[model samples]
Structures are given as C-alpha cells and as structure tokens.
Target: MAHTTKLNTDLTGKTALVTGGTKGIGKAIADELAAAGARVIISARNAPSAESTHHFIAADLTNAQQASSLARQINDEFGGIDMLINNVGGLTTPGGGYSALTDKHWEDELQLNLIAAIRLDREFIPVMTARRNAVIIHISSIAARQALWNLNLAYAVSKSALNSYSKALATELASKGVRVLTVSPGATKTPPMEKFIADYAAAQNIPEESALAQLLQQTGGIPMGRMAEPEEVASLVHYLVSPAASYLTGSIYAIDGGALPVVS
Candidate 1:
C-alpha cells in the first residue's frame, strides 16, 4: 500500500539553494519549499525577476568559476545545503532544424542545459555528503526520450546528457545519503510556451488556439490536450525532497500529460 504527502513536513531550519529559481518551474519549486518552512537561496545571472527570494545570489553559471563561487557562498551563508535544485537551462535558439543550427548554438545549449548543472553539482555534492542527508533535483526535458521537433538538435542532446548524468549521480550518492532525482516536463505552460504559441500564430496568420493545435499535432498531442502548469511539476519535486520519498532515488519522472507514446 502507498500513502500521500502532507503539507506539514515543516523544513523550518533547513536551507536550500535553487539555481534558476527566479522564474517558471524553478520559481514554483522555490515557493513550495519556502511555504514548507525552509529558507531558500535563489540564484540567476541577474537579480531574480520574480520574488522567489527569501535571499538571492546572482551568478552566471556559464562559467565554472562562478558556479564554484556561488556554491561557496551558499556554504558560507547557509552552513551547507540540505536541498539543491539544478534548474538553470533553456533552448538557445529558435532555429528549429539541425542544419540551421551552428557549432556555437550547440555549445551554448550544452553549456546551459548540461554543463552548468554538472559544474554546480561538483561544488554542491561534497558539501552535502558531509551532512549524511540531502537531496538534489535536476529539471530535464522530454526531448531526453523523444527528439525535440526540428532544429533543437543541441537542446535535445544536452538533455540526453543531463539525464545520463542525473542517473549516474543518483546511484553514486544514495549510499552517501544524498538523493538525486530528475523531472522531465513536456509542453509546460511556461513563458517560453506562450511565446511559441503566439509566434506560430503570427507566422501562420491563425488564432493562437489553431497554431497550438497544429503544433501539438506536429510534435505528439498530449493526451490531456493541455500543457502542465509549473506548480504541477513543483508538486512532484516537493514530494521527492520530502521524507515520504526517501525510498525513491536514481529515477526520472516524466510529467508530460501522457505525451510519450510508450509507458515507462
């Protein structure tokens, strides 16, 4: 038999560092963690655009030195991380086809989606290992399984690498008491999706609804016929960090509205 999670987990004195937590899914996760009584440090290249801040540390993750420095700052301020969420990532361009993308595009995509997380984790894990209890969550994308439509070659490849790294890290950390988990979200209702729908509508001179319909058909229609809200993905992350999910580790959870053709 299984049970459900409760809101009373009360992480009152715990500290967490959430990369890219300024907006979208990252912002949602930061809010959930804060509501459960944790003190969260949200980091981004600029001052957080959203109010995810109980505290904010600006850092550009594209450089490994900055990532290491940010990790050190977190250690100095919070003592050590109890939870770490690697959420800084995005598609580098709209070039939608492989040939249209250049070497620079691939490098940029990989830096943002895969390499940044690895750099930060290298700094974070050792700090957490000393504690004997901690959790790290990586936000991946559905392209990790099915390819991204057209010109997102680099983005897809980066996510695939991220998925592989996340699994390997999870296995290596379990015995040390740090749980690493990953979430892959498809067609989520983040700011980027809104822009995609709007732009496609403009390009085709169709209503946004129609454009979204055609877009869904081109990819694979979500059985639920709607994109997931950021909060919905955050809910799963919340549980994975909670004691309730202590037995779960080294797994990838896809929250894609049943868009994948096969069941895992």
Candidate 2:
C-alpha cells in the first residue's frame, strides 16, 4: 500500500462529523479526514454502512428538528464536534427549472442544501468555538456559481444560497475561534454522477456516454479532460481540516478541473 502522506495537521484527538457521509464525496471526505488521524463520524437519514472504520449516525437533515437534535447528539456522544462536513443536498426534481419547480420543491432544496448546513453551524459550531479550535467545511459545488444546468437550476440556486450562507457564517464565527470554509468540486465520478448521467441519457434520448460527453462539453471541456475521482476531492477536505489551513476561512476552493472561467 502507498504510504499516507503525513499531513501537516495531525488531528490526533479531534472528532470529525460528516453529514451525508455514507457515500460519494461525503464518504470520501470522511475517509480523508480519518486517515489524517481524526476519529470520523458519518451522519445521514439512514445509518451509513461501515465501508471503512468510522462511526455512523442516522438523522435526516430535511427536518429542522432532526438537524438540531443531531447536533446535540454529536455534542453528547462525540464530546463536541471538532470538524463538520455539511454534504447532504441535491435537486428535488430531475426536470426542474424556473417554471417547473414548485414552492415545495424550493423548500426541499433549501432545507436540504442551505438550511441543513446552517442549522449545524448554528447549533454546533458555537460549542467548537467555545473549545477554541474547530473546522467546518461545507461541501459546495461548481453549480453554485456557473448556473449551467438548466434542468438543475433549483440545485444551482440552492447551492448559490449555501455559498452565501457559508461565507456569512464564517464571518460570524471568525472571531469566535471556528473556521468555516468551502470545497467545491465539479462533475466528480461518484455514484451520483452515474445516476445523473443515466438520467440525462434517458431524458435526452442519448447514450450514457453521450450524456457524460454533454456534461464535459457544458463545463467547456474539463481542461483535464476527465471528471475528478472522489479521492481527489477528499484530499482537499483533508487539508482544509488539517492545521495546514488554519489561516483559511470564508473561501470557496474549487477543484473543478479549471472549468470555472474567471477568478473571483
């Protein structure tokens, strides 16, 4: 096995919690953090299977009550949350756009994408701040800025709000000792990507590969000519949580294969 590069930060005593961490980018993030030495906790509506060696908590974020309760549980059981990856979120309707989405659709997207992250931050980050050192990284997306997928406009919009929410939350927590950051990855080759491609293929009457091609084309050709694997995104999450990133906060770090056109 390849040696795990010793990261600058050794979370020897830290407890990390990753929301929606059962699979995909969230799972990857949790793994990376764990490998860096933090005891990782994966939370979702359903308990995350032990694909590796992390603890799992089942609590849905769509319900505000549940989000708060989960935070309390984290504090009680984990001895306070040192790191949190807010990763649960997605588009509610496959064909949703400006007119196709209803109020309920907006609510669901907002609840899952934006509110969930904020709820955790509001409920738990304060405890971390009191402890004097903690990290909170919200798993954001390129869709937050590009607004490229017409069919996923709602997803994009919800992420846009999450982007803003993360920044604002960071500013609020800056003086209090918590660091909130963002790691936005573009079309990663996760299980969700396969489903997204399959759905696009069926909806557009194209082959799955063609739908994948469409995704690349939409991103103006992922300069690297491939989607990122989950591990690559995980590496960034690992670094952000490590002491290597102590000075960082309120920044959106994009690992999008140079797909975003301009610098902000």
Model 1: lowest-lDDT 10 consecutive positions: 1-10
TM-score of each: 0.92, 0.93
lDDT tens digits, residues 15-129, model 2? 8889889988888888888887889888888765555578887888878888888888878887797888888886566564577778888888888888888888888866898
Residue 73 deviation, candidate 1, in Å? 0.9
Winning model by lDDT: 1
Task: For model 1, name the residue pairs that clash.
Answer: 96-151, 97-151
